[model samples]
Target: MQGGAQLPLPNPDSTPAVPVSGHSANGAAPGPVVQAKESLLAAAAKARKEKPAETEAEKMLREEQEIMRNITSRKALKSVMENAQGISYTRNLKTGWKPPLKVRQLSEDQAQDLRDRFHIIVEGENLLPPILDFKDMKFPAPVLRQLASKNISRPTPIQMQGLPVILAGRDMIGVAFTGSGKTLVFALPLLMLSLQEEVRMPLEGGEGPVGMIVCPSRELARQTHEVIQGYITAMKEDGLPELRSLLVMGGIDMRTQTDALRRGVHVIVATPGRLKDLLHKKRMNLDVCKFLCLDEADRMVDMGFEEDIREVLSYFKAQRQTLMFSATMPMKIKAFAESALVDPVTVNVGRAGAANLDVIQEVEYVKQEAKLVYLLECLQKTAPPVLVFAEKTADVDDIHEYLLVKGVEAVAVHGGKDQEEREAAIDEFKAGKKDVLVATDVASKGLDFPDIQHVINYDMPDEIENYVHRIGRTGRCGKTGIATSFINKNQSESILLDLKHLLQEAKQRIPPVLTVLEDPLEELRELEKASGTRGCTYCGGLGHRIGDCPKLRSQNREQQRNTKDYFGSGGFGGET
Candidate 1:
């Protein structure tokens, strides 16, 4: 490599000519040095005159540079150490997160191949380390034990890529199917961070939680809390620190949650609404929170919780590791991730807005009045442990009532229900006491209920993502399930294109009604052409039907008048 190059020096003796009446003194023009000097001066002047404004990216880059400079400064280092309480915040914590066995630097081709293989596309630095199995990246003994106990010998696609990113302490937005074990992707990291930092359960009214997991629904919140507790139990068995995890959500007593907060929990799994309420009341503080996980993040954004999520994010003082796990990646989610996550590594396991392939989808074009009849028929054919999704709370209530009157064991849950009622309904459904659970979109995402034999769409969801989520209730964890959609004209047209695409992708049969919109028949087109016009069908004349033609009316009127006049005269002559 060429080390360094030197600039050509100007002739030392080169001098500018003294112009005497547009003539050089020595009868020679200016030397190259003088020309070069003049050019340099002119370029300097032009640059100063045309200085461009700094852009946002440039500003951020400069800020990053400044931060790097400051953090390495002696004074800044001293301040950070003082704040660290004499414990250095090392790059490698005691979390048992070791670097990969052998880091192979991937070429561009290799990275592209890997990305294509996993449907993974990262936006940040190419910092992904490879791991062939769960054992490749060494986890804590207790965590590994819990995994073994659950017979989780291998990692899923999301888990495989997600664990490395989470372990490396980089924010991520994981997009996978509903049953792709998204819960554990963040749960394992949360446990690791807590254990590595030795975060203990806070004393009564002493400090706030160190980790916060915000879910979209109460059942999911409780479910996540239970999973965390499982890991906590394993940690205790391993003689690690005991952690307290709380499930904070609405439809429950605020006093109880406040008391739990006062008892000094290490982790809080909550829904956005209740969590924001607690934040407003000053009952919970997230200043010390280090791990923030948003499960079913796309659903949260769709439910109009963006502002609440942003407000919750405002409470964090120090920089926190944020992870978002969503089943579908909507534009809203992508935009939210842009604002919420910094250089997040996006792990998309498959195509977005696609339903699980294991689900068998069937669409019936039934009118609104006959939906109940069809639903009843479907219920008769389907087995128990079914989930029927409605678009409205009133519909859910009506279905629940109708089912009860029909002597079928069923329960209802919607946004209008109290938290206790929702919990009880979910509990009954989970315990198999109730074979059918009628619900709104509340239970669409993040609520894990295994053995859901069928997911019935009593009313087609307005959004495609909701439809995916509705059907996603079943077919979880590699289980074969059926999804029956009762799509009428009202829904069939608006969602016909998306529905067809989804069905095609899932390898399900597309109904005839959904096809005409995509590929209309020739006969149907001719009939539509005739019916679509305003002219009479018989004569092809505008503004009148064949039965009410003006020419025919005149002929009939003339005949009637002439017959009356002539018949009257003949009768008069005969009488004379």
Candidate 2:
């Protein structure tokens, strides 16, 4: 109980013995334990006292750093996964297996004469002689039969040059009139590429699509898919390895497309949007994609698919042959081609953006209110299978309804319609079940309605390029067709002037209304002749000069505005 009383000895039978050293029963020194506890407490107190409150800037920095870390982790994981998948799919594929370069070498004078015969202008290094006949290209027997089946006894001007350029494993920028059989130029080469890969080692699950065709619209994509499928079927029937082609586009169930990819597609005809989506989701890849065709590439860029196209290109695991085909070769396309293609052959069937000479472009001035009424009159000029293009969706619907009310067999397609409805309308029109296919510019680019007797622009498009494409729907595959445009005061004078020049260039009759308009491009044309240049080379717009290019100016203004906004919003840590 007291210090002195504790000195009494305990009973030896029941008491525990005390240690002689200054240590606890657990054998740890008590001084160090206490000192360590005190030190930790002191450090905690010191930290609390010395630490400053986090400022907003510091907090934001911390959050940004954390976000960056997470992003980096995800990217690393994706890179690893993509690498593994790439290796797996390309494992059995033979590397550097190029198709035999079966080009017909010709003298410069002979080549020039051949090009002149078809109105073709081929520009590139080591250019191959244009194939005068389909048989000269050494296409597979099946491909030739398919061509024959399609009634294509000879190569179109574009096919004449483009086929040789592409089949020689050369990247090409094919600029031709809209109906110049541009599809075959890329489609046939794509088949050869796919067959080469498939026969060597057939595609398995999670593997190919050795070739891809990117279209701006689902309709174009489906049409291209059908074209490829036809060739595939012909080849298969000829005892060649089966080549599977898949149509990848929006408005269809993604699962179906994914399943097809899983089943190993040898060729994919896809719209930019859906293809990018699938690539982003990792449901498909470009690991084995050796051939890339951008059909209606300018239209895709106009539809704001430039970023998507670039993003899709970033997904390619290997260097692939790229092909860009468009009716119009604006400066934008030229710039894009410069960056995307490797020493690409520029095969121009005619002057870029020229209206097909095969088309009879008849521009008639009509009052805006009278356009609908005049549409019927225009339709009477041609038989069934006419394409009526309007700029606005509402206008397309109105035209479709009016035609139907007038007992005209019409089907309408626009962005407003569901995918199924659009497909159905297009199919109906193509099948000749409908006399008129009323549509927006969606049907203008890269749609081959071979039998379209006429194309009537219910409303003139603002851009002459659209006019070219709309009129090009007819007069396809070497057939003469008529195009009647109802222009009114609502149409811009710039476009009217362009139309006048276009008609004059084609040697078509220009209306008095367009003739009355001042020729602003006349002086420009004279200057271009002096300098070996033509109207607004940037946009291929005949109405304006490069300095006055509306599109280029608009793009510049947008870029400046975006930069200003970015700085104004404290993008670089400036005060708002």
Candidate 3:
């Protein structure tokens, strides 16, 4: 274009290039496939120079368009490259290789030994499949290549057991720690199945996705979507049919997602509310979705997504596989699984409601008013990349601002903030642009941030499970970390016994006060044992009942005496 800012030429290496394995007999380069590369580049440059952004929204929209354009161009280039003579489709598939089913059936003693070693318990017909190594599984070469590239030689305890059950066409429940590779336990199997099904029965028009992953929060949904995208890219490069994945969640352009839906997606990683919105609006459908996964199922129930989940599930057709994964299995989660899953296999890798053993835990008995002071001191002494947690959104913001004013780079994520702000805060923290992240329990769940060295509970969470997840932010993926909590009598007294027990179980040092606080349950039992009726139901005081309670009887007698005195003394005020 004349007198326009010239767009930079696309780098041949910048395209998504896969390794070429085949060579021609003449030992020459593969024939060049023609594409409108120069014209597309010029058009993109012209579009950018033709109009200047007038507002923030406009600029954001333009940026999004540019990104989409770039992605489309790259995809086109990859297609052209794949069509070259030396690069053949289906070359990445390990032909005729399958995982051994003999290992699937283990003797009772062997299963027991395996359970003891990994703390894994399998329920329901001993259906849990054992993965001695990643290589033992029947995976596409691209999936294996991606794992090897990342140096993942063996499966985590959760992955080792969970994969087989799902692949066996059975519903499964996985209760593992926060960083136990739970996402892949389902994603890998689902993708492999989708590839097989797509080849066996090509998708009809707008048949929708064969795989669906629902996460509790937007951040977690986005993260899971990214991981799925990586696998999808690897699969595509390895000559599998193009299977598109979409992230349908709040805080992004819904129209873009709708457009993607119109085009058709093979997989969807979404949050409950947004997915419900799309489903209700008739913008998407899940009738053909064969695989369903609820990542962090316990967190979803805790966040009041049970109703939304049910509402979405009502839309799904029968004949689908289901998987539920959580860090802890509460009664609600168990009930949910019973309702959603059919004869599911339960895989528990570790003790439920326990913090990661790798974390160093400590307690600071500070009053609510003084927690800020102690937190400041702790921050001053601690290293960077710390995650501070608060019980309330307001407190998260306050702590975040206080740290900033004190000259520490910090960010905050909480329910009060919009999705964009929360995402931005998390991005900044993940990028190491911020040294500290002040957050509420919202960030404590399935969101994975790497190398977090410290987790400070500025305000100890109300629930014991929250406490476990909060501290888990630091000690992740088998890394050593520190977790310090600020506790007070008013807020933390009720959970003192359980907290102390958990810390002791993890072999962590407990504060003196925590050890001293009486257990409410034991105290109640003692009260019941001492007195048949511990307290008066009416008066709510110990050592009394409504009929014979001293306080109540005395009040009734005093009222009668007052009534008699009023009638006898008033006698019409001398001449009644």
Best by lDDT: 2
Kindly report which residue pairs in candidate 2 clash with one another. Answer: none
* Tens digit of per-residue lDDT, candidate 2, span 161-203: 8887787788789899888889989998888888888878889
Per candidate, the number of residue pairs that clash is 1, 0, 0
The best candidate by TM-score is 2
Candidate 2: stretches off by over 4 Å: 1-105, 553-576
lDDT of 3 by residue, 1-576 (tens): 788879888887776443354544466776554443468889998999987757543443355435334423421111122334333222121223344867756676776787678888787763655676777777878999998876677888888888767776777788887777788899998788778778887776567888899998888899888888998899899898978889999888999998888877888999998999999999988878778899888677656676687677667654567788888774334544655566668888776555788889988888878988788888865678999988878888788788888898998888889988988999998999989999888888887776888889887765566788888887777778889988787763435555776776788898898777655344344444554323233222222223333433554455455454344655632322
The digit string of per-residue lDDT tens for model 1 on 384-470 reads 999999998999999999999998899999989887899899999999999999999889877888889799999987556678888
* Candidate numbers sorted by TM-score from highest down: 2, 3, 1
Residue 321 local lDDT, model 3: 75
Please give the ranking of all candidate structures by lDDT, highest first, separated by commas: 2, 3, 1
TM-score of 1: 0.71
By summed lDDT, the worst window of 10 consecutive residues in model 3 runs over: 74-83
